[model samples]
Target: MASSPLGHPTRGTTGTNRLRRNDRWIAASAAFRTAADPLVIDLGFGASGVTAFELATRLTKVRADAEVIGFELDPARVATAQAQLDDVRAGRTNFSPDLRVSFAHGGFEVPLPAGRRPAAIRAMNVLRQYDEADVPDAWASMAARLSPGGMLFEGTCDEIGRIASWVDVSSAGEPERFTLSLRLAELERPGIIAERLPKALIHRNVPGERIHDLLTALDREWERAAPLSTFGATQRFLAAVTALKRLGWPVIGGRSRWRLGELTVPWDSVAPR
Candidate 1:
């Protein structure tokens, strides 16, 4: 595997199930269901491989042959995660056999053992350290390693995974959708997702931009849906998404997804104006 010239290490703060929302999204994704080679990459999976292992466990439900590989720029981080995998495989840990996870040291090129392209590449909280201007190159680098019909999910989230927003990019390198997943009960406003927007939309959240307008509209709908709060936070969130859709916004997904505090909008809806 080749190393990156622009390697920026992270603080490496990670916990068990820290990326559960993302895992859920991927497990329900069409990419996983239609993938011929069921190989997924957990790019920059911090100092531990638990998140990748957890994703593998969930993915297996969608595709029994699914496997996850954790990629890191830091070779030491890969080594540490590998040791943990060894312990789990030796019956010293509670991890299941279905969680067939491995670790590799590589950059955006995503060097796999058999020169395989991945069905999905998830790069979360990995590019926050770089300037927003560096996003395109990074996206291009990872997208190039995807299988023909593959997808790339890149985003940022709070430490505990309560709020998250990500962009799904196709193997052609065009971003397809922008999705926000939150914890609705205590959500101050739907605009909270602005803080977790992916690189493509993060800097573009300023006034006059489509992303800014989308957030503003979301906050307004959330307020309008306050009546549903009596039913429950989930109900209130569903109402907000319903409102947005009725208002002619290109909201994707149905009530089933909205019930989980998730709302997906077409990329064109919030793309930079």
Candidate 2:
């Protein structure tokens, strides 16, 4: 594959099932279910290929023809992923023998075979290391590589994957929604995601910003929902998110997703102001 025109070195830090939440969200998205092409790109999959494998495994349930390509700027990481692929091929893991996954060296400038473009791109934690000003250009580059109606999922998560947030961008590079997923049982407050916000909103979490106001309001609602804690953290979170919607926070989704500690909002509701 040709080298990406612009990219960054790999931090190479990742763990098994680190992206499970993100994977679930992608599986539920229209982009994955309706893609004319079932090809997906796992951009910047770190030191190991387990996440890529997990992504492929999860997505295939929705579209049996699903395929995943793990891209890393580090050749060594690519080699490691290749070795993992070999293990899967040899029946060393529980992954389906027909699992369609591959590894390649690439970056924001997704490099695919001639005339090929992906149906979706999951770029988790890839942009955290770059300057905020670079996010637009990086997003533009990747979005440009998507097939019609394709999507880009980009965001960050805590080390063990308990707390996560992502932005869903359309093929036009315009963000459509922002989603925050937390482990309700372990959550202390909704504001905890402030630390893990995607690059675009991390610094903007300070007062006066839309994201800041949103999180602050969410924390307040979470506090007010403490009475529901007798039921469970899940119930408490559901109540909090329900209150958020009632208060006109533009919350999306319903109890089904809130039960999983996920909250989605229109991009304009939390866009950096």
* Candidate 1 segments exceeding 4 Å error: 1-6
Candidate 2 error regions (>4 Å): 1-5
Candidate 2: give its CA RMSD in angstroms.
1.2
lDDT for each residue of candidate 1 in 178-219, tens digit (9 for 90 to 100): 999998888878898888888778888889999999889889
**Tens-place lDDT digits, model 2, residues 1-273:** 334435888586999999999999999988889988889999999999999999999999998999999998899899999998998999999987679999998888888888899999999999998899988988898999999899999999999999999999999999999999999996799899999999999999988899999999989999998998999999999888988888888898899999989999999998888
Candidate 1: residue 110 lDDT (0-100): 85
lDDT: worst 10-residue window of model 2 = 1-10
The clash number for model 2 is 0
TM-scores, all models, native as reference: 0.96, 0.97
| Highest-scoring model, lDDT | 2
